[model samples]
Target: MNETAVTAASTAPAWLAAARAHANRPTLRMRMPFVVDGEDVGSVETVVMDRIVEHLPGGHRLFFHDAAWHLQSANGNATQAMNTLAQAMRELGLNGPWRNEQLVVCNEDGKRIGMIERGLVRPLAIATCAVHLIGTAPDGRMWVQQRAFNKANNPGMWDTLMGGMVSAADSLEQALERETWEEAGLRIADLQSLRHGGHVDFQQPAEEENNAGYMRERIDWFSAVVPAHIEPANQDGEVERFELWTTAVVHDHLARGEFTPEAALLLADYFGW
Candidate 1:
């Protein structure tokens, strides 16, 4: 890689980290009419984020992390506040930097209207970090199994080669490496080449509570094509079963709803048709 690419890549997280620092504070301001109680107030500049939460009497609550005059915010545009703070959290969670983006709310009439933040929420995806890896000479291929009948969500559905969750204190690569080692007995560096199948957020709507009760995470998808000469094996109980399948057979299973929706979509594209 050239020096420019290296420098840009190295500083990417720092930019996001900076954004997160300001995200919890009111460092951004823009004027837009706020829709409240069925009325569009003229050019109201609302606070999109603050680290504090202001509790109102009754079940009503306002996250003060993004602040503004109390009256204007009672029924203000929360889309911006929520999205920006979430973005900040995504960076903060990884101890990274922040970069400014549209922080969009939603798109309408070919125009984007919302806050100054990324306009989307990603699911906190949990999957096996990796499937195949180095070991004894490759014996055909290996089927990576995510312990069937999980105590949560899907109990016994086979998923793609790699999967995992992004913890509040871990970077994407760190989480992937840790999960791969714990679940599959392989380190991320062990596999030089990995492919991202895709990911899903799987979040629910917010409720009237202390926090929104929803976790947000943008899953970095992946796949590892280990040397055929090295066979991969299951290490922990998280994997209940293992079997080798040819790319064709895997394609067939993908056609039969056998993988995660995002993974299935990616696998479909991988198989081309």
Candidate 2:
């Protein structure tokens, strides 16, 4: 092992280190790739694979080949086939909370290959995309929202100003706009100095449902300045409330683990922490 490779973590803030540790679990190494039509997409835990083999209908067709689970019959009508599989998983109690929304599934090269129920993404380890926005005031204070207690994942945790998954039917821009308006009641067009701040890739054993699934997603983060005259109101029930905090307070919250892991990582990167 390279001895010098381990010192990088010492340079990052303790909060960021904790966030990275939370987002990248060692259990991910135990999962096998989920292959579809000769394309490597997603992964499956051994336990999950076993459950599928024992409880899923037509599950016998899935076979282990080249160290991965190969689904040969999922070639045509990929979307329909994936949806059918997701529904079957739901029946077997292998899925997360169902959203009735479709999330686009992409291959290793980021090619859109299919669409599956949002709830099934974590169960199947399918990589999905989301948009997260950081709203800031001219005085360097940040706007954050508290997730509703009823949320399926990370309920009641503080998050970025606005964050949401990119549905199969919506583009990145559309998702950003929709999430911003719905979660914070702030129109994207009205924000000042809006800019995309790249993205963060996250993968970990799902903690929300007792590790019954895995989370693999790419979060596209953005930053903007909200006008002092404009106040954020929750137009959607997904948010419990919104609050603006100074930089020092935000850092303290992060250190004390008040923010969600995703938001912590994003904010850490934003502040170069």
Q: Which candidate should be chosen as best, given TM-score against the real structure?
A: 2
Please, what are the lDDT tens digits per residue for candidate 1 over residues 94-202?
A: 2112234332232222232334322122211111112222111133232445445742434566664545554433556676776677666666666644554444332
lDDT, candidate 2, 1-273, per-residue tens: 011112222356655765787787755447888987677888887677676654434432466888898665533666766776777678778888889999988998999887889988887788888999988886667899999999887889999999999999999999999989999999998998888877888988877874367888889999999999998898989999999987768778888898888988887767754
The residue ranges of model 2 lying beyond 4 angstroms of the native Cα positions read 1-12, 53-61
In model 2, how large is the Cα lDDT of residue 173? 97
Best by lDDT: 2
Per-model TM-score versus the true fold: 0.43, 0.88
Which regions of candidate 1 are displaced past 4 Å? 1-142, 195-217, 233-236
Candidate 2 minimal-lDDT segment of 10 residues: 1-10
Q: lDDT of each prediction vs. the true structure?
A: 0.38, 0.80
**C-alpha RMSD of each candidate structure in angstroms:** 15.2, 5.8
